[model samples]
Target: MNRVVTHELIHAFDHCRAHVDWFNNMKHLACSEIRAANLSGDCSFGNELSRFNFGLKQHHQQCVRDRALRSILAVRKVSREEAKLAVDQVFESCFNDHEPFGRIPHNQNEARFAYRDFQNRDRYNANL
Candidate 1:
């Protein structure tokens, strides 16, 4: 629950910080959705296992990509072909933009602010 909330909070923060027009910006929307799906446990192994309800099995990455695809399509409000094209366009970059984790931020300003905030929180926690 906390993880999902924080994930969404990060998206909302991204929108505010980047002045993202979520409804129209296909790339921006896809990028954020990709991040949220990758980070939010939507694609986690445990989560996928829990979501499964049948005999046939599938690869974990496939499950993750499918979920990510559905999420992107939902947000883009476009046909599957269009959404897939848009997602495919930014797939590599967005999938690689995992913040506060393995991937790097595409925007330097976002990285700087995130690093600063992380340091501040670390300092405050150490004091406590």
Candidate 2:
């Protein structure tokens, strides 16, 4: 439930902050999915282990790409090849765009901390 909310919130955040052509642009959708997967803890170590996808080098990235690919497939009428291509095209940039979180939250505790920091961002900025 939390993961789902986090993933969708990422899409909503992108929608509000950027000119995302969700219906007309596969790249835009791909970018959001990559960001969601990377930043929402969808590729966290525990999640990957639960899916029997741990231990490999760069597993987080591979998981993000795979999740983004699955998400694109689920929501779009694109071919696997096309979806994969789109994900691959935007993976590097989107995966690195941490934005509001500032960094990837790899677990629940980290996510909670990030949420706290996010909530206090205005206070931090006001102090600055």
Candidate 3:
């Protein structure tokens, strides 16, 4: 039996790359909470991005790849009823235990409401 890996369904927000962002060729669309909530371990989209090429035509391709790497480092799992505890834990470690992002919120429910609201607004408008 062969096991095929399906990457955790996620919404990624890649930073703006020079020409790609300008032309809107590359983008980070937010991942789906419904799909991402069920994922285990480090979630990923699973495509192998090729290493950067050099010379005038490809000089900065590596930089573009690097941006993607930095962006992926902050991902956290979502919860069904609230923002997952795992998120704060992961973000905290990434920020070296910074107070705000690292600190656990007083209410997980509020976080879910806020995150959902933002996501819904984005989805609602995106439909139009």
Q: lDDT by residue for model 1 over 35-116, one digit each (tens)? A: 7776566655556568773223545335545666788766556888877676778777767665564433224454566667
Query: Which window of 10 residues has the lowest lDDT sum in candidate 3?
Result: 1-10
- Report the number of clashing residue pairs per model: 0, 0, 3
Q: Name the lDDT of candidate 2.
A: 0.89
Who wins the lDDT comparison? 2
User: Where does model 2 exceed 4 Å of error?
Assistant: 112-128
- Find the candidate with the highest TM-score and give its number: 2
Candidate 2 lDDT over 35-80, as tens digits, reads: 9999888888888778887977888888889999999999999899
Comparing 2 with 3 on lDDT, the higher-scoring candidate is 2
- lDDT by residue for model 3 (20-95), tens: 2312221221212212221211221221123322345532322323332333333423332223322332332322
lDDT of each: 0.64, 0.89, 0.27
C-alpha lDDT of candidate 1 relative to the true structure:
0.64
Cα lDDT for residue 116, candidate 2: 85
Q: On a 0 to 100 scale, what is the lDDT of residue 33 in model 2?
A: 92
